[model samples]
Target: MVLLDVEGMKCGGCVRAVERTLQDQPGVQEASVNLVTRSAWLRLDPAALDPQQALEGALEALRSRGFSAQPRQSGVLSANAEPDRAWGWWNQWRQLMVALVLLLLSVLGHLAEAGTLSLPLIGTLPFHAGLATVALFGPGRSILRSGWAAAISGVPSMDTLVSLGVGSAYIASVVALVWPAVGWPCFFNEPVMLLGFVLLGRFLEERARRRTGRALKELAALQPSSARLVMADGSVRDVPVEMLRPGERIELLAGDRIPVDGVIEEGYSAVDLSSLTGEPLPVDAGPGTELSSGCLNLEATLVMEVRRVGRETALARIISLVEQAQARRAPIQGLADRVAGRFCYGVVSLALFTFLFWWLIGSSLWPQVLEVPVVLMDHGHGHGVHQSLGAAAQTPFGLGLQLAIAVLVVACPCALGLATPTVITVSSGLAARQGWLFRGGDVIERSAEIERVVFDKTGTLTLGRPLVEAVLMSDDPSRTIQLAASLEQTSRHPLAHALLQEAQRLNLPLLPVQDSRTVPGAGMEGTLADAPDPLRVGSLEWLRSQGVEWPAHQRDAVEAAQTGGQSLVAVSLGHRPIGLVAIDDRLRPDAVTALQRLRSQGLSLGMLSGDRRQAVERVGQTLGIQTDEMAWQLLPDQKLERLECWRQSQPVAMVGDGINDAPALAAADLGIAVGTGTQIAQDTADLVLMGDRLEALPEALGLARRTMRKIRQNLIWAFGYNLIALPVAAGVLLPGFGILLSPPLAALLMALSSVSVVVNALSLRLP
Candidate 1:
């Protein structure tokens, strides 16, 4: 699927060599070469060889054969897909060298003829003509072999035409030289000059092809050469990272990258997490915290147990995805493949038609047609009413040459083959650099059409870590706040962190309470260090058992907070009820601005959270998510079901972080998981936001839209190139307009068409 412009292909032999190299790969099922077009098509499996790898294999094969190829850039090759072509510079250099030698000999022969000086015996020879033939037959022999084969097979291609025309002209000159009676005009110099010029074009083409293939090379350059291996028994040994296996330990020195994704078993240091998660901030890592490859070790030596190896690593997986995307054949490339297939058949038909048409109309129709030997000699140049038919109108080689040239020039499927892959490759590479990895081209494309954004409440829209908003008081504020914060500090709950954070922020002096006991659903109880009473914070039933009076006003405040969806903390001192503290969770700083941008893009934002109704409403209102439009206190499964229900009429995207949210994330047409969310949630989601910012969501959607537009543009150009070139190559306009396209002109146009498609795809950079 990788589009490449290869050069150095001069004949069928060269084509076969390149094809063999690609077919050797396990994933490459087939490879087709159009010798006339100087292009090769490869179909591969993403599971085996990725696009970057495939491209490298193809380019190296061409180079080994003395041809240099590159991927064509958009506009530089095709407006849609670029032609996998090679520069003609190598051929040009060889031709130039030949021409210089030939020119020197021609001048020497001219001088020897004048007898200005006595020349050596070697100088007496006709070196000009001899050297000219050598240049045409040696390095440039591939064109001759391919062209001769087509003409003899009667399935003449561009090669057959150019070869016949040039060969006929050369042989005619030789015939005249030997016989001196069949006065055939001498155009020997033209063939020699044409050979030189053609090689120049080929060399230039080969160089361009080589340049375009650099995308894969650049991608492969990202992996490091070796890894630091941490052995057992506390000793460290250096080993090649590729040789390391799963379950092995790797020690990362300061400034080294974490070689594999693993947990820090025993170490503490400020580590740079930028490469793995795209988070620029350095995070402190200690025992039990996991890390991925490419994360830099900044402060301390650490041990990381290897969890994945080689291609199984996260960085390796990302690289694989991008490579596969580049090599993938979209529907657009198939059109080009079909057109080139048809064009191959069409050219052969035209060659036969040209040969037959002349036989039918000529005066010596029977004798001249039957007389192969005589026709081969004089080319049936007998004066019979000055018969003008087909090749007879020009030379015997003229009509067939033109037809073959048309086929070769018009049948290049470079434009069709290159359009989509080139754009995808370049864009995907850039995306990887930016830390936004797209799973596939189609996902990137579909993201552009999103009209509404749905955020999962717990881990997506909010910080997931609930922080205490305010502590409302009724009777005894100290007993209420202190008891609530202290009990939470001993528990392992998200709400506990919120309570502890609130206490720390307010600088509340923590009491040295003893025998602290948790009541599960009710709350907790403990004895204060200097007080005679045991304090208790629990439900009303628990308070009632303790003989505490539930004041109507305190009950009213608790009820109001509960109705508003806030969790209430009830306090009791000795056997009597005290004041209560009502705490609520707040929103993250970036949520409002991101939601506002999504709204501007014509999206109606809604939230689905398991948090209490009042807590959900507070966040929803703060971020402009309509309170009426929200679904509060929703379980993970319920959230998924709600999204499915909403999808009956429109596309729905669910964003979440909790394990409960996994099913919902999977059920949504597009599921976006926050990086801070649980592992299972990220695994279930279609896209993972690697950073804390939700704003990247809108940008990703925008990139998807641009990618789709570019794909469409490339498809159009791919189809359009063939639509216009096919009929013209078939000589459809010749009878009416007398406008027959020359072989070279057709070749140039075919190449230009592919370049146009590639260039069009590159325009994804716009907007």
Candidate 2:
């Protein structure tokens, strides 16, 4: 997948155009454009695509849209780099300088008229007003051009209303000057004021937009530029990761990303798998072990064969998942679209009705008695023909024009289009930086509403790995372990590994054994050369039938192991009882903290595992969950059944990491798959946690809540602005309360709301 910075993108249509252009290129599997960020991301077939050439093609597509395009060298690959800050600041400064100059001139003109100026030359008011016009028309031509295009096309965008008001006001003023009115002249200063004020808002909005894009920039910085490839001669050479191939050996240095997923062919070390699986534990590896890409090599040098490289690697695929998820649009943005589409029609209808009502009133005798006659008598109209006509037209035309300009200015719908999506975009990006992958805007919205959470035991609620805790013997401990090792050596089960590990720990040596055989369901049977009969390891019933009496102390140890939710393995030598080995699984490091945070969020946390009742209960108690909150001895289907039952009452999110948990993952309202689990579990889940830490689940939930909050705020602001401003711009309040907004003023308000939403979203940092 590739995300390239592009230029000149302005709206949804521009985004669609860039998307289509990039999709036309061969091997480009998918393409999306973020207009706000001025970027285009592409997923492609690596075998058929050349990265450098693809970027060049994208540049060509952008140029066709009338904007300069090139690969941003500093942050070309990262989604989190803010190399665009320099350009963003430049864009801001250009707008600010023009607006500030205009503002100074307008304020000076107003001050000069009030006799506040000491120097007449410095207060050359006409020249300042004309200079403001030049600033508005020349330096700020992009806004005018975009607005004019939308207006001419009859789209009636936020741009259209602003253009209509500013352009009309300024042009009318020029007309009034070139051909001075035979009555009171109109003022063009409002248009200048609108441009200056709106530009100030744009400057604020641009600063925020640039900050939001930095999340992507930071993500891009994580890529490792070079890898140390181990050559056949046993020497290492630094090479670019892109140049590595399948079957080639690579040596990982400490703190380096595993360039590709592969098997460890040599070396022994503890590897930090947190970055890849989110698992906090460092896995110790020796020869003939699997190592995934993006895992940090934390110990001795690791030699691994590259099985998957470039885009086919696990790290690349995960990056793709997050980038795709971040591009999803939120539901609240639809409200903006609805408002923008109908705003023009609604406002025009009201304006027409107002005009008709006034025209009808003019035809009535009321205009002569209440308006025209009053004006004529004030100017003493009987004295001159010019005097009568000027008084009749001057006051009314000037006031009506001013009111129309105000209405058009106040009707800009920029906020209606920007509010919700901008918030979603910025918040989602912030969440992504913290390692939460929100599948879509709805997940962020829905997750915030979750009230209950169900956890799968084994890997989720407790540490899943079993360890040998104790070994008890009825006979000589050495003789019993040696015999037990011989029997267990032939069996394949988790209990077997525990037994053998315990035997090894005791330094017990296995005597030469013959006729060694494993009874599939029963256990194992084998005869040592020194033994007079076959040694057996099976159930207590089989041992009793062999005339073996259970030792009292060994019986107590077995019972104690069961109570602790541990596996008990019994061994026998000849016809006599021997020893017992107790093994149990441990809890994860972050389970307690995760549970506490989820509980704080008002989610009822419960544990469900396939382990025995005692084992599951042990884990729940250790994590501070009450006995009523734990469920055990559940198969995959049973887990799903429990999840379904809970889902009926409230939204539930199931967090698990094994294949057995997949069914429940699918059944839950939101399936949070941990990164450390099996392949099937990762594929089956709806939302994959990039790390193995259960703590991330609550972190993600917190981030999701923030994102949803921002979305709601943005939607409310956008919707509220339209609800209030649209009615006033359409003159709904004019007839009764005389409240109306000009087009320039409407545009300014719309832009302010849009910028506010984006700024609010950008405020979500990792508190």
Candidate 3:
């Protein structure tokens, strides 16, 4: 996968175009583009990919589509050092500042006419007209040229409609100034005001985008530029980190960031892993301890041999994964993009109809149409001097032109285009902070659809390792303990450890047995020599099936242990129950609360375990799990089958941290892994709990659900805002009521509409 910092993407149309271009290239598995961040993340088949070739090919493709792009490389895009990034932001501010000055000049001209005041050598008409002309051809040149060129190319954008709105207002004002016989109003402030508002909104949106992408940017910033390369002669030289190859030894100093993934060769230090694990505590590192890139050496200088540099490092992989995940679109986002694709043409056509309706029809019926359309606008008619243009706003053509301009300026597809991508990017970052990492937007969508979550028994819901809970026997059992310890001392199972530890705690000595032989499923058997019969230790079922009578005295204790969901290892002397040991894993402190919270949110929860029915029931009862939701003694294949069955009814999420769970994880609709799990399980999971906390699971689900909600809200606002604002901009209210939206006001509202969607998405960060 490769991540590229893209530039010149103005809207969602630009995102779609860039994606289409990149995905069409060879070896490209998928291409996801984010309009908000102006970034593109690409997935490729490594077997067929040459990174340099693929990146160059993509850059050329984007260039053909009118976008500038470059693959993100470490040390090149530091916020303080990247000239292009700095200049990009500075350019936006400069344009907006200039537009504000031009707007002020235009406003003053209107004020001069309204108050019948004169200033300097320039009169009202020339002064206002000059501001409008400069605003169009000067500060607004980029917008006007892009809009005009897009329209000519038959791929009009939001800028195109804006250009038309400002241009029409300028042309109308010029006619009123030059050909006064046409009886038109000279509203020169409209164009200047439109430019000012659009630029301001764009600047703020860019700032929001920068904040949203701060995490990925921070990740890139973690890459160090220099490393102290330790030579074979025991001398150190400062060299560019990238210049150091694998197998080279480097000297790491206290307070210096590890330049690459490597093993510590000598000395000791505390490595801070906050960037990767989200934990603030530093881990102790010594000889042979593996250190990943992006960690800081907190103490003592250590000599280390580099293993992986550049993109192969863990830090680089994390950044790439996050960027790719954020770039991919959710299913709902496609709807907004489709609407935006045709939005420009639709608005243009609608504006034309608005003009024809008011001029040819409505102006004749309503006397208000004979007056200026907007009340905020002043016609300068009260000034007795420049009455040469006739009664201002008395003509139907002039009033109709204002309505048309309003429609053009007010209809914005930018909001619809931004509805999904912004939220997804922000949500991805937010999830990372909470110690959960999603592989892609598809996982987030799948998470939101989850109706049932299956939890693995041993390590998932409970503390993985077990502790002895109780010991039951039909007799004093000292001999039983001695016999059981002799049979199980050599074994390394959890139960065997428990038995050996118990005997040691009691200071009991083991008696050696001769002719010892191991049973496959049953416990080991041997001639006790001292005992009256051959001793046996295994599961109660195995003993019972072998004709060993159940001990009456220990039956109640056995029932109690079974009901408590503990593992039982029974010992027999000549088929008579000698002793029983109860062992079970402890429940996590947060497991109950987490499960309760999940249930409250309408998710069905279940326990998937390989434990027997009695043991599984005990844990299930304590965790508040219902009988139907518990599946016990299931093999790995059976667990996969359970997932399939559950998924058939509704989307199922399987949580496990074992290699055995990998198959079930792959089969489920969603798989969540504890980071402490085996590499196979974590690799199979769609999302990882990096901190290995159970509570973070619910946090992830909640974040996904909230992200979906934000997407829906933004989509609704984008669609509804356009639907409502478009007709109003077309003077729908002008016929019955005297309400008319001026082009300048329309532009301001349109600019705000997109900003509002972005702000709303940002609000998801709260709570």
TM-score of each: 0.68, 0.77, 0.83
State the lDDT of candidate 1 residue by residue for 1-767, as single tens digits: 44445554443334444555666756677665433234455667777767677767777766654556666431122323332222344445665577556645644544554565466742332343575587568745777886665445433334554465456545655664576554333333434544554554445444444444454444444455688776667777878777988888888778887766788887899998655455768999998988776677899988888887766666666555544444443344444445443444554565456544433432233233222222211112222212111223243333333344344445544444455555665566555554566544445644565565788776677666666665565555655666677755677766667667777877886777788888877778888878769888666667777788666666776667657666666677787666656655556667877877777877766788777776777777777777656888887778767787777877777777635677877777777776643244225766666667677677667666667677678667766766776566544554444444544345456556655555565555455
Segments of candidate 3 deviating more than 4 angstroms: 1-4, 16-31, 41-61, 70-81, 116-118, 222-240, 243-259, 262-274, 279-291, 295-307, 372-392, 463-584, 676-683
The CA-based lDDT of model 1 is what?
0.58
Candidate 2's displacement at residue 261, Å, is: 4.1
- Taken over the whole model, the C-alpha lDDT of each candidate is 0.58, 0.64, 0.77
Judged by lDDT against the true structure, how good is candidate 2? 0.64
lDDT order of candidates, top first: 3, 2, 1
* Higher-ranked by TM-score: 2 or 3: 3
Q: Encode model 3's per-residue lDDT on 105-168: one tens digit a residue.
A: 7666655666655766334677777887888988799998878766765567888888998998
User: What TM-score does structure 1 among the candidates reach?
Assistant: 0.68
Considering summed lDDT, which 10 consecutive residues are worst modelled in model 2? 381-390
Error of 2 at 697 (Å): 2.2
lDDT of 2 by residue, 582-645 (tens): 6677677777888898888888988887778877777777788888777888877777788888
CA RMSD per model (angstroms): 9.7, 7.3, 5.3
